[model samples]
Target: MITHIQGRLVEKNPTDVVIDCNGVGYLLNISLHTFSQIPDEESLKLFAYLIVREDSHTLYGFSSVAEREIFKLLISVNGIGASTARTMLSSITPQQVKEAIAHEDVALIQSIKGIGAKTAARVILDLKDKVLKVYDLDENEVSVNKNNTNKDEALSALEVLGFSKKQSERVLDKLLSEQPDANVETLIKDALKKL
Candidate 1:
């Protein structure tokens, strides 16, 4: 089991990298997030997950153990494959993936390209509990999930008060990201000031 690779970075691209360990050069598939996280140094280390099929062996690399763990969870779903899991990791940060599942934010999950409504819902359904348990996330922390409700209410109120839904949602997303525990009233107040 090749758990990790530490070697000279022979080549790098948005979707893959080649690392020269000793005299052997190994190519590992990677997500954009991992590609960005990789430092510009000769000596680099990446945690790896190996997928072996009857026809070929593929190696995927992650910048962190957390990202790799999420990839495993994502691929465990009935319809999600390694490529789909990599796409999910590339589309959003690992923390965002965990929060989305824990909070049941189907829209956020569906926002990724190639992910439809059903697949997004399935991701949340299949991994929500596992994510919660593995990450030790209690309601108090994912209170950000609560923010989704509060944020929706705040957006609705703003729309009724003549603000554009698109603009209101943009401002609300920023506000919620900054203050995850803010209530609907607070979100409205802050968003109103910003808008």
Candidate 2:
């Protein structure tokens, strides 16, 4: 297995990169997330995952080990292939993917291009526990940071009070952006005023 490659970045594109390691040039497939994370410098090092098939050997590269682990986890699903996994990674940040799975947000998962409702549900069902375990994610901490636990709690309370989820989310997002340190009571009160 090619764990990683450290060399000069000979070429760079959105979908792929070529690294010159000594005398050999290695081509690596990459996602947009990795492409954006790569630094514009002569020397670069990328964590790699090599896929070996009967007729082909492909190398996928990631800017971070976390992204690579997420990719591996995505491909472990029954219907998800390497390309699909790459597309998912390209479509969203690794943290978003993890949160969506942990929260069982089927609509969020299905919103990604090329993913259907069935596939999205399967992804959540198959990987929810694994994601929770691998990422050590607390269910309560899935969607909000400690500083914004109030925001999450308020959102749930609003939902239970029959507020539309989309409207509540927008209201919460705006409020959180403006006042990141707002407490639960303040968030809920502000959200109620907006709604």
The top-ranked prediction according to TM-score is 1
After superposing candidate 1, which stretches have Cα over 4 Å from the reference? 143-195
Estimate the TM-score for candidate 2.
0.74
Please, what are the lDDT tens digits per residue for candidate 1 over residues 1-195?
999999999999999999999999999999999999999999999999999999999999999999999999999999999999999999999999998999988768877999986898899889988998999989677654666757767877998999997899999999988888888899999999999
Please give the CA lDDT of all the candidate structures. 0.91, 0.89
* TM agreement with the true structure for every prediction: 0.77, 0.74
lDDT of 2 by residue, 1-195 (tens): 889999999999999999999979999999999999999999999999999999999999999999999999999999999999999999999888988888776656776999986899899889988998988878777655544446557877898899987899899989989998898889999999999
**What lDDT does candidate 1 reach at residue 27?**
99
